[model samples]
Target: MIQAAAAILKKEITQELRTKYALNTILAFTGATLLLILFTLRAHQMDPTPKSGLVWIIILFASMTGMTRSFVQEAEKKTWAFLQLHANATEVYLGKLIYNFLFLLLLHVFTFFFYLIMMDMAIQSHLYFMSAIIFGAASLASVTTLTSAMIAQADRKGALFSVLCIPLVVPLLLILTRVTRFALIEGAASGALNDLAALVGYCGVTITAGILLFDYIWND
Candidate 1:
């Protein structure tokens, strides 16, 4: 299982390095969105609530753009059948999940840094805010990775991806936004524990569920 997963992960990383499809698309979209937000709100002061919400909003759409192609590319190139022949469902799913998680982590870090600089968003508790970002990215990656696999064979993958992901990710976004807002306020450490816990729990649940159900989704 480990070797199979590693092979798949290496294949994904190699393909991505060669083609740069997902990375280029995600970076371009993120840059355009950040520029729009910066120009649109240059004169106004955004409170923490709206600021935090906007950060996740950009992340949501950016992730949708990049991660939706996870399995769809395989299916489109007819390499999915090749993967199925060589790797078990669990191996494929785990490899994809790790790849997505790492990709999202990098994207989120880039987004957060630019968001802070472009939007002038300040943080009071850098530690807490970074924690929320980590768990939030994990949760998003887990859910979207599974959804990408499930919708690999769909005709309208982009539309269906958003339709399926939005409802599933609402709770995650809410928790992330709340925690991020808490992290922005001075001495608000006590309030973020619950939200952080919720984010962690959501990540755990989604990952476990994705692992358990991936075989069915893959083989279907």
Candidate 2:
């Protein structure tokens, strides 16, 4: 099972890196998002308090643009059937989960730098911000993996993925946004630790759910 899963992940990651498509799309999307935010808010007197939830909401949707592509590409190529045939549905899901997580992780890191630069948001503490972003990214990954699987076969993949994913991700997004807000207003050490804990718990639960449900999705 481990070997089968590993092989699948390796294949997915190879395709992901070998093609300029996913990375380029994500980068362009992130850039456009950042530009829009900056443009819209530059003339207004914005709250000095960082609205962490708002930030994460943007991140989540931005990340989705790429998540939609992950499995949709396979569906387009008609290669998903080949994957399903070689591996158990569960294994295929695991492989996709791993690949999706890695992709989101990299996006979070890159976006963080751009966010700081463009948003001009002063970090109260880099450590807390880092921890919050990492946890938030993980949550995004887990939720996205399942949603992508759910919509993999849909004709309108993005629309379906968002409808299914956003509501489920609300609690995590709320906590993440609040935490970032606090970090902006109160600084890292002073931010609400409880929210961070919630983010952690949300990630754990979401990932587990994805893992367990993945087989059903793949087989369906």
Please, what are the lDDT tens digits per residue for candidate 1 over residues 1-220?
9999998889889999999999999999998988888787652276656887788898999999999999999999999889889999999998998899889999998998888877666788877788878888889989999999989998999999999999999999889888888877543666677887888899999999999999999988
TM-score of 1: 0.95
Q: For each candidate, how many residue pairs have backbone atoms clashing (under 3 Å)?
A: 0, 2
Worst 10 residues of 1 by lDDT: 40-49
Clashing pairs in 2: 52-177, 53-177
lDDT of 2 at 37: 75
Candidate 2: which stretches are off by over 4 Å?
43-45, 188-191
CA shift of 27, model 1, Å: 0.7
Residue 152 of model 2: what lDDT? Answer: 76
Q: How many backbone clashes does candidate 1 have?
A: 0
For residues 115-149, write the lDDT of model 2, one tens digit per residue. 76665667786656777777777788778878877
lDDT of 1 at 4: 92
Local distance difference test scores for all models:
0.88, 0.76
